[model samples]
Target: MGMEAYQAQFADHLPGGGPAWLSDLRQAAATRFSSQGLPDRKVEEWRYTNLKPVQAQLFALDAVSAGAAPPALLESSYRLVFSNGVLQSGANDLPTGVRLAGMAETLSESPGSLAAHMGQINAGQDLPLPALNQALSRDGYILSIDPGVMVERPMEVLFLSDAGTCYPRNLVLAGAGSEATVVEHYLGRGDGEYFVNAVTEIHAALGAKLRRYKIQQDAFGASHVATLAGQLGDDAHFENFDLNLGGQLVRSEIHMALAGQGAEAALNGVYLLRGKQHCDNAIQMDHVVGATNSHQDYRGILDDKAHAVFQGKITVRPDAQGIEGHQLNKTLLLSDDAEIDSKPELEILADDVKCSHGATAGELDETGLFYLRSRGIPEAEARQLLMTAFIAETVAHIGHDDVRAVMERLVGEWMAQ
Candidate 1:
């Protein structure tokens, strides 16, 4: 069918409607999607990962089935389930001091607090996916932690794809002096070709600690894009890890603002791709206050005709004195056709700040591979061993042992395939 057909199909799918904001957002999105027309490689921010993979095909929006077929309780632990973009609280096990449910419900319950951070951090012209989500998606899960509350369990946002294409929007708010952990997993049968467009906004209050993880493994013909915007306050800490093992094409955008003095932000990611898959990781951090600290480290392993891209930027404002920021990106390409791209940028305006960025793309050391082979290790085994060591550097930083082990195993599994 044509573009107009799909547009109408998507519009018709909206739940017969409610709320003035909901109606306004849909009309605005339709106009924007028409004019913007799915950004192309011409845009600087998306020069590497061409979005034609999704634009070339038609995606029929999946309808909302909030409490569809009770979500299975995976032995992995506490969780929340979102099927086809609607939040289901009955299917979840939420910890105390927090309320997890549809965004509409949260907004109705507390409009002042809900609208404070919604679309505030992750707003900009460079991010198209998030804009598209904000325009078309009206419902998502909201997690609000009461002040001084330390949650005991990790909150998992499990998005299960039921049909053709899905959009999952999530909003997270952590109150001052509160601590929590969130794990987001995109999992389903890798049979149907579809798109999973998701956006997550986080607000970190003073002295709050949050550890977040992302695990992506959808169908082979699927494409996925996710945007994460984080706002930090004094003494706040945010640690995020992303593991991209499977997706025909995947890209993740992390926009963080070290907004307060003494706040810290760390972004760590590992991407393992083989065959003709494509993956990109973009990290942009802004040191907006004096004495703030930030660090980013990412590693990618590619084989066959796969491709990997990493772009990171560290910005220091004029008055942001005594800022300390560092960034490092490394990639290992295993095949002649496989390619990797790395771009690290540092823009400093403060005189007393120390900031630097570095990037490198190369293959595993042939000497190390040869030495292992001469020691009686099989050639394939030798290659796998070296690949593991190359990515373990970033995995070692995870404070949680179980999460670290899961990440490492995912790396090994992707390499073995």
Candidate 2:
């Protein structure tokens, strides 16, 4: 199906009667998406990933009611649940200085606040997927933290997809001197074909700290594409981590801009792929001001005929002196047929910047496997131990204990399989 077909089928059915600014934004986004359409391999950024599989299917807007149970939740945290892009449950006992509401509700109750930050980050970019999402998305959440307010507990957003296609657009705003953590968990329900196109925009004010984590565990027949864009203020700290374990075709793209001095950004991820799964991680870090710092670390474990791609680029502006940026990507190929394409780049235009990047892809260490086997450990157990140790560094970066424990358990389960 073409872009015109998609617009004709889903555009008119979108929710209406919102603020006029939002209406104009959606229309403009739709026009951009219609003109550009889905990206192809010819595009430089998308050269390693293909979207033909996504374009071949005709997805429906309405999803099948799966009613499946959600994965394990955090022991103590505020939670919001969405099934097939519709809100099913939300937390009502939010602490003082914290505000949370569904996108539709926020648009109705506080359109002014929602309008202030909705399309501000990626406004003039020629990004097609985000434009598509902005045009078709109907439901998501809006989370805001008041200045100087510290939220002790984490906020969890769970997305459960069963069938069909859903576009979820989310926004997060952290006021000056505030601190909080947010987790996005995506889980597939049944054996059905579906598509999940999600976009999340984040803003961190001066001296604020925000930690964001995502776990994508889609069904085997699902296609998941998501984009996360963030802008950081002076002295702000932003940390992002992704755990990709499922989906037939998956692309996780992240863009971060350190627009203020003394700001910092950390990006880390681990992906476990098997069978014929395809996973791609695209990262872009920009040091727009002086004295900014950014770091990227990603690890991948692939088996069978699984294929993975890691593309990361860090850019330092001409006047961005005293900047420090580093990126590293490592992959472990468990089977002879498995493949990985790792690319790490640094574009530095400043004279006094410390910027470097490295990428490595190879099989597991045979010497370490043999030493573990020599200790009377079974071969399979030794392989699992080696793989576990390989990803331990990235997992240790998680600030929350409960979330780190969950990641360990998931890694154990995946290794057992």
Candidate 3:
């Protein structure tokens, strides 16, 4: 079916009911989506990946059936789950200093609270996927941390999808001098084909510290698209890590802006794929002021006919002096037919900036494999060890001990494939 057919079927049933301003925002976003449509390879940002498969499939705007329960990724942590774009109020006993609510409830109670930050990040640009999400999103979570409040326990926002399409929009606001950790987990049930388009926005105020992680483990016949937009204030610290393991076609994009001086940001990711799976990760960091530091590191392991792409871009404005930015991307192709495309780019307009980027893609080292074999280790086990070590270099950057342990276990499970 065409875009018009899809829109005609569900545009009237889109969620979110608030003041006139929000209604206008949703209308404008829908118009934007209608004009731009789905991105194609001609677009420079999506030149390496194709969306024909997603376009050709017909997906319902709402879930047709209930999906299986989500995994225990954050069993002990405070959790809020959304099944088929509907929030489930189970296990929501949050600790002090943390406030979480669904978007529908917030819109009905206090719409003005969302007016200030909602649709504020993409005011200048027209990102079609995110615009589509805004137009059709049914449910998501809004989390806020009071100033100077520190939450000892981590939080998780889990999403489960069945054989349908779900657009989920999430927001995270960290007040000044506050500290918090959040995990965004996406999962799927059954072998049915589906599509997920998700968007998340985060803001960290002065002296605030925020750590966020995204784990995408969809069904084998699913297509996943997600965007993360973040802004950091003066002396604020923000760190994000992404892990992509499942889904037939997956694309993840991250955009971070260091709006205040002395702000620090870090982006790290890992993707493992086999068979005909395809995964693409794009990261863009903007240094808007001086004394800002940012880093980007990503690694991928591909086997069989899998394909992966990594693109990292860092921009330093003219007045953004004393900035330090670095990006590195590496991939290991475990089979002859496997492929990878790595692009590490830097655009520096400041004279006093220190920026560097590098990319490398190749197979395992024969010498290292031979050395391990001489030690009575099987070739398969030796290869797994080498690949694990290669990916550990990037995973070690994760700060939280529990989160890092989960990521390590996921890596080990991938290697066991």
lDDT of each: 0.77, 0.88, 0.85
lDDT of 2 at 316: 90
**TM-score of every candidate:** 0.90, 0.97, 0.95
Candidate 3, residues 211-303: lDDT per residue as tens digits?
A: 999888888899999899998999999999999998998999998999999999999999999999999998889999999999999999999
For residues 1-417, could you state the per-residue lDDT of candidate 2 as single tens digits?
A: 566876785566555778888888888888888788889999988998899877754346775555855644687889887888877777679999998767887788877768888867962245888887887788887889999999999889988988888888899999999999989998987756788989999999999999999999999899999999999999999999999998999999998999989999999999999999999999999999999999999999999999999999898989999999999899999999999998887888999998888888889999999999999999999999999999999989888888889889998999999
lDDT of each residue in 208-232, candidate 1, tens digit only: 9888888887666888888888889
> What is the full ranking by lDDT, best candidate first?
2, 3, 1
TM-score of 3: 0.95
Clashes of 1: 1
What lDDT is obtained when candidate 2 is compared to the true structure?
0.88
What value does the lDDT take at residue 331 in candidate 3?
92
Best by TM-score: 2
Clashing pairs in 1: 190-219
The runs of at least 3 residues in candidate 3 whose Cα sits more than 4 Å from the true structure, single-residue gaps closed, are: 1-10, 56-59, 123-125
